[model samples]
Target chain A: MKKVGIVTGGTTKFTKTDISIESLLVSAIKQIFDNSSNLSQKDVDVVLTSTNANNKYLANITSELSGMAPKIAHSVESLCNSGTNCIVSAYAYISSGLADVALVAGAEKTDSPGLVLDWDKSRGQYKHPIYWSSMFTSAHKRKFGTTLEDLAYVGANNHRNALDTPYAYFEKPFSVEEIMESKPLTENLRLLDCSMPCNGSAAILLASENVIKNFCEQPIWMTGIGQKAISASFTKNDDLTSMKSTILSASDAYKMSKKAAEDIDAAELHDAFSICEIIELEDLGLVPKGEGGSYVRRLYDTKDRKINPRGGLIGTGHPLGATGIAQTIEICQQLQGKAGKRQIDGAKTGLIHNMSAAATSSTVLILES
Target chain B: MNKFEQELRNGNFVCGECSKCNKLVWPPSDLCNNCFNNVKWRPISKIAKLVEFSSKNDEYFCIAEFENQIRVMGKVENILNLHVGQTLTLVKCGFDGKEIFVFGLGD
Candidate 1:
């Protein structure tokens, strides 16, 4: 297999507002290329792009960009997983020798006002597995005795994590007590737990060994990659509390990397909701099931492990298409031991896991120094 | 809230029950998640619990937990910071001259 290395990466801020996703994406790409001496717009072998926007202008903007070679310029959409899956496809291209270097980028300007994007019709049809399994969350709340306050722990933890992150949209610190006393949405979920739409783009350079030699001397290696996508129907699965896709994807990545969950130093999981991060920790086997909550509690009480040190989507923002790539950028920083204020401290191996809405499609990646 | 056009109103807000695998899903899906086969749509009890949650108010926007079934969580609603064991149900009401179903304290 060809060796793949992430030469450099970047992320925009996490905030609440509307912005042109296409423009933000272009600017993000430009920033990455501008920062790198080895990478010009010319070195980008192919461009893997993801977004949730339906703007007509975005298509035009992409077509005019640099480095997207003719016939190689492709777009991949797994809705929210687009950002992360872009990294997966880019690695595949470089490792398979199809390309020497690739630019996997995700960007969304969901904060752009009056953008009436709708996918709820698909939810009724169960078109995606996440909505398939997760939408029931509404009715599930009705059947079970669980309260929305239980979900507050997740939001409170994420907000606290954001307090240390400069790029985080909400910089205030929150506690579980504060979160529980807040407000409610859909019973068990809170506004703080849900990710606000953001206006930003994240781009990463995936290069082969040869390409890395031309880029930077100290590039982070793309250590392992794995993905799985089944329909969103939770009825077909044996378990209801966790994600089959998340478990399977992480397992595949671990197997490919010859690493175990314990070997990872830090991580970033999709936190579309605060509970999402808590459950994903267990689903990815970072902690035992039912133990994830306790683990998060301890992490908050003591501040160890530093999961989602970048504030995740809940504290930062979730711009759909930009989320996966943004997480990758965060992972690269951790693996390089350069997260600055949010550094994982001696982190050598890092992991990233993401989903496409309500846990339908999921991707897991392993990166190392 | 004249949401007469809302799809959840026209349909039962389906869930899935796979006899083949004996698994259950809410807002039902087409295939059995376990058996990977076609499943039957089952009407849910609609009354769920609030197992997990968070709360926040960022000036103009707001969020809090309500309740749901096992593991995964539902959306945020216009309530207060609820305890871990609060009970609730999906309720239909009129808000600002609009008819809608919102999660509220259950009896």
Candidate 2:
């Protein structure tokens, strides 16, 4: 198989503003054309749109709006991780020589139907994500003695980091005390611990090694990709203290990339909720098991930008389908030395973790400059 | 509604057990996940062990496992010093656009 690389990417500001999904996707795609010096509609051989919206023929619609007619066009829907799923499809097309250049765009509306997994009857009346997150929190606390303060630090740090992220939904940071006092969604979860569903879109241009330099002066290589789905039902996740899918996917990603967690200079974790970050830190091998709380405490205490530098889902706003693509864009920018204030100094490699439906499924990507 | 919903609607918690492999199919599917064989429906045990729980506005909800395989989230009643691995009896269950499972500890 041939090599694939990310040539350029663009994202619209995440907000609660009402916008058409088609328009949101086009807005982000337009940025790719505006930013890339030599990229044109004709150069794109594949167009894949990712969103939870019920709209039909979205990829074709996006391509028409963006003035592109590609050999391959379709949509990818896997709930929260749809963005990366779309990018992965594009990577497959480029690497397999089916296509040399691919355009991947993802977007979501604030009221997108992807928020709830209604089909998972195992969830019963507790279908909303918070219920599942609460269970995870309760178990993690029981297993690791993770305090509410540790959860609060995850929120506080991400919100603080968002202040420097221009496209993030939150403009202000909340103190740890304030986050602790934020409206209680459950006994173990607070309103601030959850990510806000908002309107946003992100687009990325992928090309084979042969043509990547034509679109980007500094290309970020997609070295490794890993994805796993344990089950669609949330209850099938037997281990609440950790995301099993994340662990398995991260292991595969590390093996494929020939790199360990230590090689990840910067990372964008799937902090859909506060406890999620703590668990993901441990499950991804970034920190020792049962030590995620302390590791995050250290990151917060030292104001480190190594994790979720783009503010993660909690502070950046989660637009579901757009989330994974946006996360990949953050790491790309980090590796490209263009993340500005959120940049980790001298970052040469980065990781992006995205999951769907209560961590029942996950996708991990390892990228290098 | 499918067989699962219909059963819950009638206040009977039934699950599909594979006829070929004797595997219990959860979330109530007609086809067994293990062997792809037809399944027979049977009432699940009312007694369940608590997996985990949390409260919303003083109202507790929890995950309950039955037969060591089936698990579902439901509202907990008669909560008196509840803890994980503790057993609770399913007092009531139903379906009204949403599956509802109610577990109780005491009369």
**Top model number, lDDT:** 2
True contacts kept of each: 0.02, 0.83
What is the Cα-based lDDT of residue A265 in candidate 2? 97
How much is A117 displaced in model 1, in angstroms? 10
Q: Model 1, range B1-107, lDDT digits (tens) per residue?
A: 11223334653334557768767743335666577887765554556555433222321111112223322223435556655456656554222222123455656
| Candidate 1 regions with alpha-carbon error over 4 angstroms | A56-60, A66-71, A111-150, A233-238, B1-107
The TM-score of candidate 1's chain A against the true chain A comes to 0.88
Q: What residue runs in model 2 are displaced by over 4 Å at the alpha carbon? A: none
B5 in model 2: Cα distance from truth in Å?
1.0
Clashes of each: 70, 0
The CAPRI quality class of candidate 2 comes to high
Candidate whose TM-score is highest:
2
The most accurate candidate by DockQ is 2
Q: For model 2, how does the per-residue alpha-carbon lDDT over A1-369 read when each residue is reduced to its tens digit? A: 988999889999999889999999999999999999788899999999999999999999999988999999999999999999999999999999999999999999999999999999888899999999999999999999999999999999999999998999999999999999999999999999999999999999999999888888899999989999999999999989989999899999999989999999999999999999999999999999999999888999999989999899999999999999999999999999999988899999899999999999999999999
Candidate 1 lDDT over A29-142, as tens digits, reads 776777688666666677777776656534335647653543367677677788778788888888889888887667777543212213333222223223332333333344
Could you tell me the lDDT of residue B58 within candidate 1? 24
